[model samples]
Every structure is written in structure tokens, then in C-alpha cells.
Target: MAGSQGEGWRPARPAGWRRRMARLPLLMYRAGLGPLFGNRLLVLHHTGRVSGLDRTVVLEVVALDREVPAWTLASGFGPTADWYRNLKESPRTTIQVGSHRVPVTAHFLSAEEGGRIMARYAPRHPRVARRLCAFMGFEVDGSEDSFRRAGERIPFVRLVRSPAPGPAAG
Candidate 1:
């Protein structure tokens, strides 16, 4: 397994799959995964700081220690990536995994902490890692190296898990 501590990576997809994925349009590329993977894609809802309205986007989440925390990217693929920039401005967020929706806040990790998380969570796809590395501009050693450098361009949000609300004790 390519990982450490809370994060890790799975094996890479075959070349045939890569070609098929590359052929997909951006919107289709993002949506196709929903049906194919179902309940696996996480939907992130955030209020646009300027618009003051909610914007929703889908992201692939890396689940760390089950009950501990989850990690997601803001802009590792590109500094101009819109979804990531939005989250950076407004940390307040709602996350949907499967049918469950939970309210949480995003906290951007420092470069060092992000490197630590990346050491564990880097994915195996070289294409993906390469794209991330391009944005981060760091020397890549392996998936972990790419993951750590990916933080350079992308903001890392540590989901601030909140306690579930309950009935007030009378």
C-alpha cells in the first residue's frame, strides 16, 4: 500500500480505462463517476463569499482514520481551480457522502501538515499525480512525493467534524 498514517493509495487504473476517461468531456467526466461509482463521490456545498449563495461541487474524498478526519483538495490540480478557491474563501461547508449530509467547516493545513497527509493519501495514478505536481511545482519522488508537493498549489482542508445535534435535555 502506498500510504502512511491516516492516508493511503490504491493501485492505478489500466491504460484502457485511462483512454476512456480522457475522452470524456469535463462535465461528463465529473458526472460519469457518480453513476459508475455511486454513493462514493462526495458532494461539497459551500456558500460563495461574493455571491452569498450556495454552490455545490463533487469531489473524491480520501477517508483517513475512520472516525478521525477526512481530507479533500482545494486546488492541487491547478491554482485556478474554482471549487478549491471557493472553499478557501469560505470554510463553512456541507458534505454529502452517500445520502448522509453533514455540516462542517474547512481548515487549511500548513504546508508541512499537508505533506504529512499526502505521504499517506497519494493516489497511484501518475497522470493525476503529474497534474497535481504541475500545480504544486515540487520534485516528485513517488506518490508520496507528489502528494506532498500537490499541497503547494492546492489548499488542504481538514474537515472540522461537529457533534451531531440532538434534542436539548429538559
Candidate 2:
């Protein structure tokens, strides 16, 4: 009953122990333990839209085109997520994945584009795609079409890196 449309599948913000536990990986990354899985995950640093303070979050890379030094990420918590909003307020930011750290800009992708990305992604990483779908409240039947549908409902962003570290957009 996860991906039935409406608000049945919306992700709620984590709190208490859940919030603290979810931050463990970010802590590890700060402690120099990021390289272990940096190829697949990244630590994003954005300025809070309201607080004007720096914030960080770990996001799984949905797609990575190293040729362009760009990475795609999905907002499982929807477009209103804190980090997503933060990035919108300041598109210029930094991300660290493994040993690769770069200044990047966040570009929001249309749902159709997201669907296409997911379609291509599912074939390459079926297990991860399935898990992602489930986590996003998408109850897919393990089919590419279903996965694509789920992607259409999720907001996606493309992080494009600059040639050099740039000044903050804020």
C-alpha cells in the first residue's frame, strides 16, 4: 500500500532516535570514514533556508555520469524536504563522495526525466532500485515500468560540478 498516490506514501520527517541513527554515516564521513562507500553515496552540505546555518545530509547517488562530473539524487521525502529546500535556496554547494570533493549546482529535474532515469537505473541496479522504491513508499512489482512510475512521483536533482570550487551562491 505504499505507492497508491494521494498522501498515503509520503515520508514523514524522522525524529528522536531515528534522526540520530540516520546521522551516523555523516558522522563517519566527517571522521574520515567516507571513502569506504563514497562512490555510491555522497555527503551534501547546504545552507538551511530559514536558519541560514550550514546543514549536511547523506544521499545515495541514483545516477552518476562521471564524464560530466554530474550525479542524480531523488528526494524520497518529496520536494519539501529540508535539504532539497536548502539546495534550492543556494544551488551552489559542495559534496563529498569517497575522496572526490567538488563544488556543484543543483538542478531540479522534471518528473518525466526522473522516470526515464529510473527506467535506465533499474536494469543496472535492480536490488538497490527495489529497495529505493520501497523506501519511497512505492510498492512496485519489480517491473521497470512500475519503477519508472515511482520515479515520476519522486523529485530528482542533478548535481553538476564546477571546474573549481566556486564561491557560495548564497
Candidate 3:
């Protein structure tokens, strides 16, 4: 895993059994193991744009917006990542976080917004933030500026949950 995390790596989409095996973690979370991850990780249930089939992926939550009740995500595999593309094709989806599931709508964030978010995140989660930058094929000196630069290069999305039915509506 460490070798694959190198900056030179630019892996294409997983094929054959690899793709099938990747869903195992997602399954674990959906099968009531979500509490182990807390809010840092989430399981996204989405539909493939071309295949029109439901898909699931476990992603790390880069940021959380309590006010808006949203989770911000980053594509470590770059902007053209399959799940990211799929969300763009169908913005409406569901996310499972810490034993809870909710309907969400995807909203792409600007590079500047990503920069600000990354800068703020670095101090709070220094080790994880650095690891994330490394995994994303970036190098950082553990500074907010360095993290911001790396963040600007990655694609981020804000997943805002849909409003629940009020008592009057029900």
C-alpha cells in the first residue's frame, strides 16, 4: 500500500475482481459497522452514469458542515474518479455516516474554497492531512499554504442532505 501511495502512481480504474473486492468495506459499513468510522468516513450510494446500476464507495470526509448538515469530500484519485463522475451525472444520492443514512445532493466546490478548507483542516489533523496530501500525489511541508496548494489541485464536493418531511407535510 505504501508503494502504491507514491506520487508517481496514476492508476486507472480498477478492473475485474479488484473492482468487486473494493466494495467489501462499503458492505461492512452498511451492515452495521459504521460506528467504527464515526464522521471521518462515509459510505456513498450512487448510480453509475453509463451502466445505470447502483454502486457504493467508502470515502473519507474531508470536512463537515454542521450548520448546513453536509459533508465535504475530496477525490484522492483525482477529478476524473469514477464516483466523482457518477455523482456529477446524478447529483442526488445517499450517504451513510456513523450508523445514519440520509439523502444528499452533490455540489462541486471551487478551488479557492478547497484551499481554505484544507488550510483550516491541516492544524487540526496534521498527520492525517499530510498523509492525505501524500496519497493524493502531493508533497507538503505541513504548512497551511502547502496544504492549500495541494487542495486546490484536487476536486471537492459538498454533499448537502435533503430536508426531512415536517410534521405538517406528513
Best by TM-score: 2
**Reference-based TM-score of each model:** 0.60, 0.88, 0.81
For candidate 2, the TM-score is 0.88
lDDT of 1 at 15: 73
Worst 10 residues of 3 by lDDT: 161-170
Q: Give the residue spans of candidate 2 off by over 4 A.
A: 1-9, 164-170
Q: How do the residues 1-170 of candidate 1 rate in per-residue lDDT, one tens digit apiece?
A: 12332232222332796745634432442454445534335667776667766666666564333465464554444434555667678666676655456666677777777666666655644565555554344456665666666554345666665565211100
Against the reference, the lDDT scores of all candidates come to: 0.54, 0.84, 0.80
Tens-place lDDT digits, model 2, residues 81-132? 8989888888888888886678999999998999999899889999988887
List pairs with backbone clashes in candidate 1: 4-120, 7-120, 8-120
List candidate 1 stretches off by more than 4 Å.
1-40, 77-81, 123-127, 135-147, 150-153, 164-170
Clashing pairs in 2: 38-98
By lDDT, who's the top model here? Answer: 2
For candidate 3, lDDT tens digit of each residue in 15-82?
Answer: 89987786666777867888888898898888878988878789989899888899999887777788
RMSD for each model, in Å, please?
Answer: 9.8, 2.5, 5.5
Give the better candidate number (1 or 3) by lDDT.
3
Q: Better model by lDDT, 1 or 2?
A: 2
